[model samples]
Target: MTQSPYVLVLFYSRHGSVSEMAKHIARGINKVNGMEAMIRQVPDVSDTTKMASPALPENGSPYCTLEELAGCSGLAIGSPSYFGSMAAPLKHFIDQTSTLWMTGQLIDKPACGFTSASTMHGGQEQCIHSMMTPLLHHGMLWLGLPYKNKELISTQSGGTPYGASHLANSTYEISLTSDEKVLCEAQGKRLAETALKLKK
Candidate 1:
């Protein structure tokens, strides 16, 4: 039997906020008829001097495979902002997609980015942009939360035209603002819908 077309919601969440956003995005993708969300996570990487993640993750989604990335109808990349860019693990996974790039496997696929930050000004947009760079280089059509999302205008927390985002403000822990969740869902729905149309 054929598998349903899915939008890959791939992310790296060190502190859990980005993972929450990924779930919300997956919820939105499921709302679209005939589309599904395939949520996956990248394992943390470290240099030889540092310890690496175990072969299996301790929690959350399993590590993503290249075949899954190549087969997806759409893609959403999520990560926590790390000094104005995406976290290292996400970059590491993205860096591995050059084989897909060389094969043109992901060309024309609809794609989007999402991010979280510990502070309000912690470079959410920059992190999303950093995620987008690789997708663009892969020839994927980039999608973003449009102004029509209204959350983009009304949000006091995290939302942007470049992509979905969240302000975690974690002194103790991280969480999404209501507006951030709405925009994330909107971004997911947009990507799924566009991907369906393009698949036809």
Candidate 2:
């Protein structure tokens, strides 16, 4: 039997906001008949002055492996914003994927990014760009939500043409706006469709 095409949804969530966005993206991926969504999370990084994470995650999704990145047909990477950038744990994980980079394992695979921030102007777009850099180095095809998605064009909240985002608010409630949800789904669909076309 032929294998179902899978999109790997990899993210790092400090306060659960980014993880929620990943689920929304997965919903969109599943909407496509021929695609599968594999959701994974990265371990938290400690300072050299502190301890690394335990071998198994104490709670949420399983830790991601380089093999997941190598085998995925498409990718959606997300993280909580850290000073207008992706958080260190996710970046640390990506930094270890040099073997995949050398072999061009991710070349031409469709990829997109999302982020969550604590405030309205928390540099969501910058986080998206930062997440895309390693994917670009691996030669993955970048996917973004198109203006055709009505929510993207009109969203006053966390939706962006770059990718989906959530304004976690001052209290860090982590609720996704309606537009944010739509754009996450749109982004997922876009990446899956692009991967299918590239596979052909």
Off by over 4 Å in 2: 1-3, 49-51
Candidate closest to the true structure, highest lDDT:
1
lDDT of 2 at 25: 95
Q: Could you give candidate 2's per-residue lDDT for residues 1-200 as a string of tens digits?
A: 85578999999998888989999999998888788899999887788623278989999888988887888999999998788899888888888999999999999899999998888888899999999998999999888888899987788878888888888875458778888888888888888777777888
TM-score of each: 0.96, 0.95
lDDT of 1 by residue, 1-200 (tens): 99889999999988788899999999999999989999999988886523378888898998899999999999999998899899888888888888999999999999999988878899988888899888899999999888988889888888989999888768335678889888889999999999999999
Instruction: Give the total clashing residue pairs for model 2.
Output: 0
